[model samples]
Target chain A: MKLYEHEALGSIFKKYKIPVPRYVFSAEMNDAVRQFVDKEPGVVIKSMVLVGKRGKAGAVKVVSDKSQVEKVFSDLATREVYGERSIGALVEEKLDIEKEFYLSVTYSTKDRAPAIIFSEHGGMDVEEIDPKLIHTYIVSDVRSVYPYQIRQFLAGIGFSDKELLRPLSEVIVNVYNAFWGSESRLLEINPLVVARSGDKRKIVAADAVVILDDDASVNPAVVYGARSAQGRPLTQREQDAILIDQGDHRGKAGSYVELDGDIAMMTFGGGGSTVTAETAIEAGLRIANLTDIGGNPPAEKMYRISRIILSKPGLKGVLVCGGTASNTRIDVTLGEGLAKALDDMNAEGKLDKNLVWVVRRSGPEYVKGLKMLHECFVRNGIRGEIYDSQLPITEAPIRLKELLIKLVGYKPEEVV
Target chain B: MKGTVYLNDKTGIVVIGATGREASQVIKESETLYPGIIKAGITPGKGGSSELPVPVFDTLKEAVSDPKVGKLLNTALIYVPPVSVLDAVMECLDNGIKVLYIITEHVPIRDSEVIYQEKVRRGAIIVGGTSLGCFVPSVGRIGAIGGKDPTVAFRDGGIVVISKSGGLTVTTAEMFKRRGWGTYMALAIGGDIISNTTYADVLQEIKGDPRVKGVVMLGEPGGSYEEQVAGLIMSGGFDKPVAAFISGRFQERMPEGVAFGHAGAIVERGMGKATDKIARLEAAGKKYPVKVAFYYHDLVKTIESLGVPRDFEDSTTEHVKPLYSTF
Candidate 1:
């Protein structure tokens, strides 16, 4: 789940015509913030970070005087909330709150459906509020969340006034539509404030937290363009990996996270790689990085990944493992790709002679691939052990550790 | 009996998007293993031309309407892109295709939901949206699951290897193969967010098969599929001596909501943690004689202890020899 920050969510709400206060998002007290505050004397300043509970963290403040806006924004900008520095501060026109309601649409794993949770009491913690006051409805389908159902749900939660229910139901329907349309996992509007401006009253979302489903193919434009899952920015290595993945159309290749460890590891398949990583960690091995190579990528792609994994500093050993081969040829991944990469590194005198390598693979041409990899290791004078499909997938990491102990006299740490 | 299991030897097959690279390669390889099984190929606007013995038709309806191809199209192997998978699946379901192997990845979740709902309504079985497809050793192979060589990881046996990860399917099968055991069938159910078929669903069908004396399941964290399988076992629906391996234990230590590998392999709000799956499956195993393998090697050992058949050793050598020549 990738969460859109306050400014992004506010923009989305505005685009959908859901009521929200006019806001300016900026890193500093720029022209936009100046103009936004000039129009409204009273403004609410919020640190634009993905983490919640900003009010409790002192990341949000209500500034009644225009002179206090810059100081509040600057103070919030310098402080890190929940370990994430504020990307910017959302300066918005403060509303005259008459009442507050809470509305959220999210998928319920237990019900296996989209659920809408609404409460009359909104701005504060919904969890602490009386459970009886909260109304929950699990929509069988997003398309089938009818106005009658919404009205009934609202009425049950003490929203009985016809005029109030009329606009509330419309907001409910639109919120549901937006949730479903965006394929969002969670769309929460806390403090769905009923504001009074002179004689007119309107319901507006004061704060929004929208987490789009990572599986959904959301429009890049709507998502504020190529957002990172880390909620900040991509590292140089991650960016390079993404570029390599984009460079090829042939098998799937990407996902590289650098860690502080000596052993560089790459595993194949989704579940298999995680299991391998866990097993390595269990055996007192700290992983330098994690790379998933599957879909039978060509030799060149494998070569690139192997190069990247090897390039990481403090690499004592390299473990390349995966589950049984389905369509991806084991020979291509190891023999033609990784083995070649290792050979090239060896020729350049970049590879340490004592650096242990463990290759465990299954699938097509297991014997031949293992043979090629074995020969390459011998030729490069790189100490390594190779296992075929016969060995269980999880055993490779332990075996690598044992080999590291025997060959390099490396002592296993008691980290469990 | 809940849904059709179209992996048997008698079931005929068709290759949708047959002219595509992956489809054509798998078709050619499958012919060597299970000859005469692939009856028809469908590629829009590429009809009249033949992909060797299998005839190419413009649409599924065109192929199903032909007298020679009508009766031999029970299974449809879809090789269309992710965007077109839902339509391709609907076409197969409409044409009375009992089983669909959706061999595409990155299919939108909304589209997967529609495909899943339609499959249930029609009492049909779907293998995957990102699946490597299924391989029934000696019967036939669908998709490119077994690689260019099927014999490396597969052989005729009593164990049924069902996995969310396609790569693990081969690994589990090979584990049995090395132990002088063979699988009754290996189903790569695909590690997608919305799998058309779940482990429990497959377990229900495999439980009835007399040939399948035991089962090997390879599961990953994310979703409740493993929990559901545990439920089925606890409820006495699955009677076989099951050896299960659930991966992604390391994900629990990582930050929540970061996808480890597959899109489906994610731990959210601590719901689908690997430790939880292991505990649930282990608790259920205590009541129903289930064996949970924390490591892949443990799974291999558990299967080895379950006395089935040791006739695979001779066949393994013979089958593996032919594979060397293919390269």
Candidate 2:
């Protein structure tokens, strides 16, 4: 789950006591945003979208004239940056003239440990800076990392100004705390500015780029509503599929991303789903969605996902494929779960008899599961066949393509 | 023996979160393949009980104190929840358990970092946090690699398989089974973003093992694990043929940073893209016997083109004369 700038500032930054510039966010010219712009000498108007590069995308603007505040806010709020429309716009108090520093806490996969990357040079084009200008520390323990160590490192890095060292180092340490506390995969503060306001001096995080741990058990994930793979709001069917794994840890059928295709994909397993989707797409089967349904989700979960998958409009076929499961019982997921869903939908006259079907699954009780599912197909008059381990896991998608061409009248010219 | 660092039939096992329903099923199913290997269970309050097939203990400390389990307890299979994974792993590391397979998922990244530190400190082999486990078809199983019936999914032969996805681990093995050269050892190293046992780490370990002939790798997007394996093969660390099939190529066409389900399986700004991984592997193929399969089913054909033996006969055994018996 990736947090929007407003969310990270509100939920994580304040909780960790990371000093942040005063800001107000709203979808419209609400009183909070209006009052914030009126009181502040200057404000930075930022579009509240999860994707990055707001400035390059022309979604961020600075307003000094009070007359232009509402204009800028309305413009940013209504703008679509990088294929994602703004949820809202964040009006923040513009910081004073200051020096900027870079700090981020993330797990460096190369080192296989948490890494704190600090750079004396920060702000835009920080990536273009000299390699030696940046300093990195492999954090053995985030808890044991003290302020003095960072303060000393700051002093050693030519930031001999004793005043800037303490506040800067403290915020750097607080970023780590915020990262671990929020269970974030990445917590980056580019241009952690050393700004002076009137007679007061402060160190503030000017930007927050956070990628929270996607695990459902995480605090942020629990608090924040789910977003689509495109980092946009979920569709109605996507929203419906999410409830399947809300409180249930039994298995995982909730991970579904709708695509612009006709075939409703109910793929299983993280690896299995990927392999199946790749084969399905390469075999010229336009997959409607992608799901990592494995760990043997219950019949209820399976039934819910099946309904959501079938509910998509303009479905040419339904392709349910997965690799040979090691532990996931085929009978429960396919037979009891998916078969029941087919029966219920058919009874409701919601089943599309014209849509072709192809299912390939294996694992515990696969024989019984395939038999039950095949019977459901027979009863519903659906054009489909069931396959077991004898079929190469990748062959299912090709089989679906062949059936689509022969039965559904799909053209071979569409083949990639 | 599978390998010195790996599990075998004689490896005494301890199950964390043992009394849980899923753990019980894993214990029951695993016992069928390697009976009596599971010596004890740890549930933090189920001490002195026999709820699972093995004796249940309040903690790993109590389980290790018992003379019956202490000497033989060398491997651990953790089925605990995400939060308790670090502590459970610490306990196992402290108990001198050299080989550990963690089956838990959604483990916080911080916990994984700490586990990585402890694993380095103790020099223990840690498999997964979201792994289905590993198996040596010739010896026994650890975790839930082969499901209920090992024979249905796995057959002991020559090729070694290392997959990030547990389901593909079995699929890769089944793909090899049809060609008559069944998997010698298969390890589902987990789909976690911070994977402990990578393709390179496992490849380095199994490189010297006489049983495994060719390597079958299943990779997803995200992380440099596959790239690291290519580096290893190029450096001549592993002198065996390798065939790899990387998935999630279609996502590269969608968007840069959309994490398609698996956190590790993502294409972010040309980094960890299927195209880059394939190009790297193909580049390394010039240095060693590395073949990159564009399609999943075509992976076996790539390995077969490398001239890997169809059976589990090392070069030494291939030339030995058989003893004649009196009829």
Candidate 3:
């Protein structure tokens, strides 16, 4: 993930060959004060927290008098911004403004590619903008982007003014290049301030967010800062799970949450789990969580992975899936680790009744593992039924749908 | 004896990288192949190691070195990746290894090219660069360890399969698996291409094998491996009935300069389009029928209607147990 400081964000406009007011960053307020004391009114002093909504959070300020700079700086410097542990704040010179807009390039988890978005009305909660009004374009291949396509997108967004159109178009193309070039996940410029529409329209980002790419193994210098923008970007428990993965380097581990559903899942491989999760979402069941037990994780490590996932209080059930049977070894028995997890949850009455486990595995030692799972379920008296491979992996979502049918008091063959 | 014919009674096969899941699925796949031998897994560090019931050794040399080891046995499958594949292969060669099957993907094209040159020098028969490995019905199997239950898809039949995508192999196999369609043998020579073994190599093997009457080839964009195989077919290299499928057509509608899926697909530019491959197949022969399937079910139907000879008396009754049960 990329962490672009306010100053770096200002430089992005310069890189795109667009115009922007001067931006400077310093560890101490005195250096900032010394640099800005000579400047008259129209200087903006903003607390630079990595989190968003600095305006709502009262971290942004407009200062004209030199004497008031210290109070404004002190108020934001010492105070916690956005209720997050305060990191630091930034200060910038105010733009001679006329209009505000929003533009961004983000990787769509759904499409599994980079998408560019633009909004004529910016400087507000982007979420509030009608998706229909927002223009989006998906780049299927990394190599296919062109400057003309970006220009077309700007025209489609209804930018009639030539002066505004040219710079906005340039910014769009640059951001797309920057995203693909740097492997950034998100590049957002809110309040894409436009200084009037006709002759000398200046387009500048009053605020910006650059989330570096996570999929590709690009060096951080090519993207943004090494550390992520500060916030509880993940739940405390999710953070703990990441810690476990890092702590146990022997196993392949990672956790991610798709915003669409409530059914938390953990499986293996880079692709199969995604396909399975997509199937589940397509099947209309909520995905509570997403995790992967990559590679041939030892039995103990498998237990640790399972424990971390089960520890999440909001999870409903998990779909323990693996790569195609031929490609890799999938756990057949649910294994000792998972069985132990079940036992612990049972002991503490933590195994939720709505819990439905679907497993599809092949490879060596499958029978023994399956035998162990049957015995575990019998011993635990859990309301569980196992479909031990009388079906294919694709049959999993279909079978899970059946189990859900039983739980919701609907007929087993309910179309849903 | 061709298309993974077993000369012995042993049902189990040894995988060089047995610690992997692919090896496991291959073990489970024996039901389709008509089970006989027990699988033995061998890794480098864990000699005398056992992941399941199968025994694992530190090295192939150690595994085969023992005097107590009986018979030349069935083929040995290798799942070791590209970086370490050369050593795994050399060890197999040094130990008097025969009937070698490799399932590893992305063995640097240069490395494979070298291996091919070495094989020609040594006169050793090696199969694969990107292979799903191979399956021998009613005897033993190697590579792509577990997939649903191979038994459901593969049975004693006339249809023989050689595919380049591992997932497509399973999907193709699943067509028969779901409908109880059986096959004499199914080999997934995965990835976009293989350096040593091409479709022609397997076609000759299948044509010679009395059990196989038809051959199915699965192709993706990038390499001309499939086209080379087609050229051999056009020149009357083998008389076996052939059916093929070439995917990645959806890639055309997508803007140029965009990646479709696998890294190998980057070459789907200019003349390398999916249509070109299909045209090449048609030009090869009127009998060489090629189907297009973006989805597995569609591919399954295409295989079902190929009009290949059937071996199983009853097409629907056999329900192969899953390789492993989740319950």
Candidate 4:
């Protein structure tokens, strides 16, 4: 099962009956730091972004006095540690602890049933601990988790007394309830801290990681701050693309991606793009973008996607490669678009001698398109190379690599 | 001499509804790669004018009669809707263009089966009843509506890709791109159970190819094909390392065997459990050892682990070159 980071999963646990320490999320580190210093001098300042092992990543910090709070918050929030967008830090009150415990409930892929795992010893890497100490019970039915079932499972983990067992069992039951309700792939509570005897102690979850099954479509708001399984906030572009793909809005075929590379590669088939990218990479060339030219679409739609790929500032080249399998033809739009771009570049005097334009067009209408492309380049005197071959995809990269090395002086031997 | 060839004496790609925009795309892509592309001379009453540059006659015979026309690429990429795919694929196959790559989708499965059997008799390569069609990178791509993107998609790498799902093949490619481990070739033959070609065919192709150093197979729950392929590897012929990750583990948690997306995703007693496939492969590894390879065991270490004996481990970066090095 995949693991979810603190803010996303911890938020879920604090919603269900699981006892977790009080916490607050804020966009401003200054405000969060001020609140922590004023309310509790000793508190944990954690980066609220989605990432694992923040404690090790130095995203997590602990401050004892009021003065250190600002320094810790700024340090944790300023740097971009993982790929997640900076959302500031989560400040929370430190739970008073005497001892720690471990517990988890998850659906077993092998057994085809829900399983509960519990341990008296917790916190320090639950996975590294003895698998035997983490007592496990597979339950096919949810209703089977009665008071006695919880006792049986807890007793297996060395809890014999009813007094300590009663409240712990209730916590275990509610946890499973929340887990099942959330349809979580995994619910891990590392070091469910148990309070000391005779002082009114409570078991609080020290850490939580919950991987929710997206297919369940259980609203994230219901569970509180649970991000999608991808473990990152949905970029507007990505969300928009998903929406368009699922609906009939676009009606045209296209795939898009925003990357650091300059060249925007929008090819016909999935197979062709893979080969082209691999070839470019192997040749010590970089692909600034990747996209699919999708099946039959109106010319307008095709132009729109081509424009998007070309819109990238660094995009210096475009590769239009497709396979020839029986029927189908490479459209003139592929040629027309490249020609249009070249005309723009020439008019703007932006066309570089080193700029590479390669097109491997196949299928029925290929002859006309290839001829059209050749005429356009020749008439314009724009530099490029085109190959009409019956070779497998593996050979295309070699050709591209050879052209790049010969024309651009790129080292062909270096592995990308 | 043993290199894979996209076109052969028996392979001649045909375009149905040759005048339509969809058919035009098929004609353009196919003919550009394969020079001797013979379009199916069919356009109902308007057979007088050539569809694009290709000769068009009133009947399939007139199309095949061209001296340049070799064996018919029987499988037609029907640009027409569901109503026309049945007649189109049937006519092409009946006239002996056995290998049909139907680009059109949503055609009733029953109609697909009828054409499927007829093509089987003729020994035609009927790729899609409902398919994204297929692509062979630089060599040639068939039924690919998207012109050039696929040329770059199936770039040169060592992973032999076999997928039951069509779009999932795209996801697999993305993974390869992310890991910087390109692929030798990936065949997404579509999810039709009576698929035109089986994983066995693709695996056999990979086994015979010297360039494929490793095989990365993507299998979902259902069908005994995974078992069949696993058994084929057990015969010790597949010298390349096989690395795979089986999805549909979530499906096993369901009540019983239920068909998922692919026709082959059925969980019978001996079929379609991700763990079971893993177990079978593990067991096969014990007996045959060299034939079965797993992908999860570190991408770097996979070559050494996949039955390529220790003495022969090519430690140099020379063997580590991209799969398309020879290309």
Candidate 5:
């Protein structure tokens, strides 16, 4: 649910009346960029990405000459920042920096309240900043935080200049307003600069890092459009997987993220799925995708996700794993739901016979569930292993690897 | 709030979204565990209809005002949609329902914040946004935790099990069952960033409860709940020995902000790391009988190392047999 810089500045920040330097973002240089360049005295070209510290990644550049604008935009847009391809390039008016400060609005788990974090020293990443220097103000009210309140805190934190205090406090309030108005889980403005606007000094948000609440009642996807958690475009399988739980709270069978490995995983429960995926990776089983399925989803709910999991191309292995369930009926989720999916795929000749499969699940009616799944494996001649809770949850990966090594000549860098 | 979560003669229950599939299913399963606790159901405009085996009321107010239902009901289980949670919670608070167990996940953070403010202002006990349920063996259960018959995994002994995830809560209990032990209480506090009911809150409420001897906590890699629990154990309220398991340790190697399974399980700004949280627990362990386990499966052995006394009982109930008859 993270928003790109352009997305935030164009809509949310402006809606909150936070001063943002005029900017234009595009995949390629266009007339808008040329007009924007003609108006601003100085321009900063930044790579539009979800990850922070784009400056450190050499994705940001200063265009001193107008002739270099298109080349810089192309360079920033084409480059990958921290392993993710740049979505586009953002061109903004570079401010004449008088000073910089740090500000953000996010939830503080310790206080169970919305916290506005402020620091006089900016431009440094949050981790590098001295924890003591950062002042935290817990706001019980999510509706608003008044400017005078921030003004008092700013003066207490050594803001002696009365002229700068009011405007800066208003800016801070606007930032909080943006965060609260947009229902953002996190909105950080690093290096919020006190810039010289002709003869007057103005406060402006130099950079924005926004991660919207995905679970918000407002459906962030409607505003931000649909996206994968990894800041990439959604694959067809991922799109289908997300639609499984839309407006349906029966049980969550959705939460799917595509990875670059060869194993298609149908893991259940949040904690169970994470533990299984970590073990699978440690055991050197490349995961093609990851999913967290649980909460006693109906048989049909499981049927759809199961089909999506098995429909992925180039998957050499399939791992169905989870901890012992509390209430999720294995007979429904697996015995009936997944069994039917496998039958359908097999009938359509979409099922891959050469792929190795391993399942380690236990819970209510798991015996019937595993028995039904085993019949599918038998009928399709799929080679793999199936285990219940007798096998250690962490050991499911090693068991899959063992079967893979024996049956498919899978090799691990280290001796097992 | 001492026995509010536990089902007893004084406990009165109402299902907010009783007509919903999940809510009705929980009502059915919970009735088998303990009937009469769930006195009524509330789904607007469904009044005078008997769908979930309980009398349906149009609103929480109407249900709370009934002579047969209102006088006894003190707790509510909410299963409404994410957007309607704020209103549902407010109604519960206004109606004097002391205990609320919310089974809905994906509740907006702002809504959770408002709920927290009001819950504090009113001094009401609230649990979960994505919580599985609360359980007290031989007493009753709330939400869909511990399955239809929790006795299959849970038996009243002397232990208290607290976990961030419902699956891990049951897994911990089942593991203890293998070694012939059970829990006095096992509940999921939910893994949302803003947890209305946290480990510390539960520990505070359960302070000096005689049925609880020790506690085994299953933690994840996000939120400061585990750290707060460590602080509470170090303080005077939690005198009993505790064992903790913080899962997702490998997240230390991944990118900082990558989302783990839980919404609150992401590591941001070098905070909420499993190693850091474990370090805090280990620090508290020096002053308290806190045992830390790194791996998920290592929790049982870690808790057993505490050497606390257990009220040994024949945990072998008839429930476990039929469920595992396939084996």
Candidate 6:
């Protein structure tokens, strides 16, 4: 997951003995900047938010005077950056920059290995930098990043001076070590400053962004204290989904994301879910939320997921689709869990009277499951259509869209 | 024959973490469906006890030391937790397991990298870390892939099926079953960001098997595995007709960096788009003459049009013999 703020990454860099700018994290607009401003000529104020491109969002500001620091701090602290409210503000001692450099490490799917990218131009968008100035090196193994490779890359990027290359290469090695140690998927140091103050020149990381892998097995509690997808706190629905999956070991029914759409879509399997979502969208159905109910989840978990999907506002219909089940019993996920959930919603008047439901599933006991779903929908006085595994999974969305246009009185263009 | 991978009657099997909940359930089901396949079990501390007729050992070393296990074991079905998957894999490799089917999910990428490197060094084939495993009809099912009832969707035939999604593996098999076609073998390589095996790896094996007259590949948007398959096809790796379906085309409309479903199912920096995969595969198909299926049902039509060998003209009248006669 992405690190929430610069402070989190700074702490990690410090642990690796990498030099970073002195900084202090604060929630209040009070004297946080006073200490940093007195130590350095200027202080950089940054909003502590999970979202990126803070500089472009005006969430970052540099001020030399203490009087200006409070205004800039309040401006960033009060505003929301990329839909996420700032938890606090970071005040760091600004560095005396003689030269700026960019360094990052990430897995390259093309190479199927860890790759490092270094650029002499930093403190700006690396994408806009000249392609000739960027040097990329892909490591064949994850065990170690050789120093000679770093020297080679630096030299390729026109770092011919030995004195400059020596310190820069050392910083790169430390950053690589930190990335490897934390099992991070992404580690970026933008504007790795070459500070020339008085008669001393030192290389230091001015800004850092680190995203650790979600797998807790590598280093438990290395990044976030708890397992989380987004850097920020989990939404209520997300927490409920996690609880439901953890409550039992029978099957997996987690990873729920609420989307801005009118159709409540519950899909089975990871790849299956994406394909279902894409198909639904293609057929002119906007998905209200995405739910994965696979690995043969029990009826209880399925009911909870279904209920949550229906509870979302502006839902015009519900679509439950998945790849043909192998080990997952269709009777449990669809017949008992999903149908039961719809019945409850109908009873509670939570479901719209005109809402249409469509389900396409296949596997062992699919006939019985389909029959049970048909009976439940009929008993609940719900308008619905059901297709067994005989139909290709890709047809679920197109079929559902057609049904919605016909039964719900939706226009052809509206239902598309 | 040297690079080909296949599961047959002679392939012995062992289950790691055999005493675990999911593993135990799968073992019991497999035992009922196909006996005499699972030869041994491995649980770190739950050795000496038996998970039914299959004997248990504390370690891979201990399990392989037994003359009965040493003589028969060739494949390992791993069901260990994510934390211990790397160690379990190393142990299996150290003990001479040639083929590994890791059913565990959420394995750390770092550990996966190490496992992958070691696998290459040892020249072993690994199926998955988050996979449902493979099924060779009339031979045996290595993992809980074809569900509680394998015969419902699978049979011995001329088609070899490979998919990244576990659910689709059975679904594709069902499609073939509906069309009076049967699968020679079906495998799910897992939908994780990094799978031990890819469509190309399985396709290479299918090329060597004369029984596999055609191939069906179910790929999704995310990694370049689909592109790799296209590359192989362009290189003329197989002589049989190949019908490919790449899902998640709508992800291109969604926001970048937002994963639609699987960990690997994300489009970033304009890479791993369903559109790109489709375009590349279609372009390659022109040169290689592969059939590209946009809609899922189209796969069946593509395969049928190619006229792969089949047993029955109509699925309604034919009653194929079940792998397990007792069932």
Q: Output the number of the lDDT-best candidate.
A: 5
| Model 5 lDDT tens row, A1-416 | 88999999998998999999888998888898889899987799999888778889999898888888878889998888888888789999888999888899999999999888999888888878898899988897655579989987887878656888888888888888888778899999998988997899999999998989988878888777888666667899889888898878888898788777788999999888888887787788888787899888999999999998888788887888987887789889988899889888888999898888778888878888888878777776667677776666777777778777887788753423
How would you encode candidate 2's per-residue C-alpha lDDT over B253-327 as one tens digit per residue?
675566665667866535677777888899999979999998998887898899887763221122212111011
lDDT of 1 by residue, B148-196 (tens): 7777777787788888888778777776787778877888888777787
iRMSD of prediction 6: 7.9
Judged by lDDT against the true structure, how good is candidate 3?
Answer: 0.58
lDDT of 1 by residue, A1-416 (tens): 45545544555676666778877778787887888888996999888877778999989899997778788889886678877778778888889999999999876544445678888888887767787888888776544767788888777767755678878888887787777777776788888989998898888888888876655765432446545554556567766676665634467666676667889887898767877888898888878887778877788888888888888767788888887776677778888888898899988978777678777777777778877877777777777667666456677788779777877777765765
Score each candidate by Cα lDDT. 0.77, 0.82, 0.58, 0.55, 0.82, 0.77
The DockQ of predicted model 6 stands at 0.37
Per-residue CA lDDT of candidate 3, range B252-308, in tens? 543343332332443322535666777787677565544444332344556556666
Report RMSD for candidate 1.
Answer: 4.2
For residue B57, model 1's alpha carbon misses the true position, in angstroms, by: 2.0
Question: What is the per-residue lDDT of model 3 for residues A1-416, given as tens digits with 9 covering 90 to 100?
Answer: 44635644655545655455566654457765656645645567677666667788877888777778777777776566656544455667767788887788764422334678787777787877876778788765555677677777677767666565666677777777665554455678787787643455677767767654232343343344333222424565455555554434343454533233445576554334444554565566666665545445456666666766766665545576643444333343265767777778778887775666666654445566656766776677654445444445545765666666676542322223
Candidate 3, residue A346: lDDT: 78
List of clashing residue pairs for candidate 2? none
B33, model 5: CA deviation in Å? Answer: 2.6
Judged by DockQ cut-offs, the docking class of candidate 4 is incorrect
lDDT of 5 by residue, B240-299 (tens): 878888877766755456576888888877778888889999999888888897666677
Candidate 2 stretches greater than 4 Å from native: A125-134, A151-163, A198-201, A412-416, B1-4, B312-327
Better of 2 and 5 by lDDT: 5
TM-score of each: 0.89, 0.93, 0.51, 0.52, 0.94, 0.90
- Tell how far residue A210 is off in model 1, in angstroms: 2.8
Candidate number of the best DockQ = 5
Off by over 4 Å in 4: A1-18, A29-37, A80-86, A98-192, A195-198, A208-264, A267-283, A290-305, A311-317, A321-353, A360-389, B1-161, B164-327
**In order, what DockQ does each candidate have?**
0.38, 0.35, 0.09, 0.04, 0.47, 0.37
> What C-alpha RMSD does candidate 2 show over the true interface residues after superposing them?
11.3
Predicted candidate 4 versus true structure: per-residue lDDT over A234-317, tens digit per residue: 334333333333323222333454445555465554434444554555445556654544444444455555555655565455
TM-score of chain A of each: 0.89, 0.94, 0.60, 0.67, 0.92, 0.90
Task: Give lDDT tens digits, candidate 2, residues A262-328.
Answer: 9899888889888888888888877888888988888989999998899899999888888888878
Among all candidates shown, the one with the greatest TM-score: 5
For candidate 1, the per-residue lDDT at B71 reads 82
